[model samples]
Target: MLPIFLKTLPFFAIIALGWFAARIRFFPPVATEWLTKFVFYFALSAMLFRFSAALDLTSLWDPAFVMAYLGGSLTVWLIGMAVARARGLSLPEMAMEAHCCVIGNTGFLGVPMLVVLLGPQAVGPVLMVLIVDLLVFSTLITLIISGSGRGPIGWRTVAPLLKGLVGNPMIISMAAGLVWAWLRLPLPDPLVEFLDLLGAAATPGALFAIGASLVARSASRIGPAIWLSFAKLTLHPLAVGIAAFGIFGVQPFAAGVMVAAAALPVAGNVYILAQHFNVAMQRVSTTILISTAASIVTIPFVIHWITGGLP
Candidate 1:
């Protein structure tokens, strides 16, 4: 247990450093934004593309694993929506709130954390979770939020969704890599080296940006954000654990990885999406901060449980 915790320490420690830097205004305010953009567009996509390219195409397909993950997340999202409705949140706000409940920082946090905790093999499963969270759950939220706006939800709403999906570098890279893998195309030495450099930066850079984002003003209403954080850090993983180990009967190691991925902090993308839709921005942003900071404690226990730690 101590060994697992020690191994996981550096990732969160880097995040804390980023938070401290931001709080101190160590770098220009806008620098973190540029770092985030570089991560989303360049480093993260490059890592995904390179991993997918090298992986066996057969290893990338795991329908049962994917479904189990989505099932747990959808359940949590629905619960969030219900809670939002009880609180009299508007439709778009409810949608965004529900999204914040489920779509975690799987790409930036889960991928690197799991890679450190588990190994390189964790990449495929983590990437699969990323794809589903972005494509399926995010698309669903967009449609709901669009419908909640003044205008009717029509082909116009879907056009932007399609456009955004097409323009997303991560999706594009994943597609290209899958195609390369299918064809068994070999990457040139120089290209592989370049990608390796980019991939190496993805983890630390992302953690830094996440910490900086936390320095901004968060939602004032701490109560709801706390509950949402609880749901994200606790309930979400419990649901995933049941689905993976009981329902799906996955192998022990794979199931453990699935639960750990599910246990990751709420995604930074939630705040981006909330800001874009202009709904529940403060609340969702605060949720990200709380869930992330809390994960430093919660995640260690989760890893120990998954690994069968003894007293």
Candidate 2:
């Protein structure tokens, strides 16, 4: 555990540095926004594409892995909803809280960190987890929120959902890369070098962006924030671990990666959804802030246990 913690320290340190910079007015909010856009649209997309292009779909796709991750995520999602309902939250608010419980920062944090820690093989499982979260759970929340409000689920809601999925750069890049791999197309040397150069920026840029963004989030609504954080850093991973290991019997390596991914903090995008819907924005923001701070310790412990002190 100590060794794993040591290995992870620099990542958190970078985050702290970003926080300090932002707090001190060195990295401004505007700069953080642009940095996030660059990483999301360019650097991270390049990385995903390169990784996806290198591997065939057969090696990447696993029905059992998908089922295990979905089952575990849904378990936590339901628990979150129940807790929110018990607290007398509205349907949309309950959906938002449930979103916080299950959607980890897989795109920004998990992909770069897990692949580096667990190896290239972790890419497939991590991507699968990201896909499940994006496709299934994200869509579910949108539908729930839409249906709960003004009228029935009509073309208005479904159209934007479909558009968002289609327009998402991560999904597009991954799909393009997979198609390239399926056709057995060799990446030109120049293109490979270009992608390598761009993707190299993803890790540090993303970590820094996360830290800078957290500067604006205050620890308001402590009780619910802590509950959501606990759900994310503890319950989420535990449920996923059980499903992957005990129920679905996923391959050990993939299962470990999935568990680690599950252990990540509440995604930044969850706050975006809350803000968009004008529901529980403070709670979501607080959860992201708390969960991320907590994950600095929780993540290393999880990695140490999953690797059995091997690495």
Candidate 3:
């Protein structure tokens, strides 16, 4: 466990460094935003595309794995909604809290970190998890919020969701890479080198950006934040683990990766959605801050349990 914790430390340390820099004003908010944009559009996309390009489409598509992850995540999402409703939150606020429960930081944090710790085999399952969260659950929340007080769901309400998904750089990069893989296209030597160079920035830059972004988040809503963090860092993984291993019988290694991905903190994107919709923004922001900090310890423990300390 200590070894696993040590291995994961540098990643979180980079995040902490970013947080510290922003906290001290050495890295301002505008700089953080630009850095996040760079990672989202360029460095991270290059890494995801390169990774997806190398994967066999068959390996990336697993109905069992998808079912297991979605089942587990949806279970947690429903639980979050129930709790929020018990607390008397509005429909949008309940949706936002439920969103925080299931959406892990797979793109920025899980993709880079899991591939490094768990190996290249981790990429396929991690991508599957990302797809489920981005496509299924994200769309679910958008639909719930859009249809809430806007009266009747129509193309007008649904069009923005389609546009957001279509224009998403992560989805675009992954799909394009999969297409390139389907055709068995060979990447040129020069192109490979360019991608490698740019992609290398993804890990550190993403970690730093996450840390810097947290500086702007105030931990004002401690009680709800703690509950959401618990749901994310603990209940999410437990539910996913059961669905993967016990119910669906996903492959052991893929199931392990799925559980680890589920264990990630509330994604930074969750806060983006909350802020955009102006629903439970403080709770979502504080949840991200708390969960990310807590994951520094929880994540390593999870990896150690799943991997049996082999690495």
lDDT of each: 0.85, 0.93, 0.95
Better of 1 and 2 by lDDT: 2
Ranking by TM-score: 3, 2, 1
TM-score per candidate: 0.95, 0.98, 0.98
Give stretches of model 2 more than 4 Å off.
309-311
Sort by lDDT, best first.
3, 2, 1
Task: Name the 10 consecutive residues with the lowest summed lDDT in model 1.
Answer: 302-311
| C-alpha lDDT of residue 68 in model 2 | 92
Model 2 scores worst on lDDT over the 10 consecutive residues at: 302-311
- Reference-based lDDT, residue 92, model 2: 96
lDDT of 3: 0.95
In each prediction, how many residue pairs overlap at the backbone (N, C-alpha, C within less than 3 A)? Answer: 1, 0, 0
What local lDDT does model 3 show for residue 183? Answer: 93
Q: Count backbone overlaps in model 2.
A: 0
| Cα lDDT for residue 112, candidate 3 | 96
lDDT of 3 by residue, 19-104 (tens): 99999999999999999999999999999999989899977799999999999999999999999999998999999999999999
lDDT of 2 by residue, 1-311 (tens): 78889988888888899899999999999999999999999999999999989986877888889999999999999999999999999999999999999999999999999998888988899999998999999999999997796788999989989998999999999999889999999999999999999999999999999999999999899999999999999999999999999999999989999999999999999988888878899999999999999999899999998889334
Q: How accurate is candidate 2 locally (lDDT)?
A: 0.93
Task: For candidate 2, give the lDDT of residue 264.
Answer: 98
Query: For candidate 1, what is the lDDT?
Result: 0.85
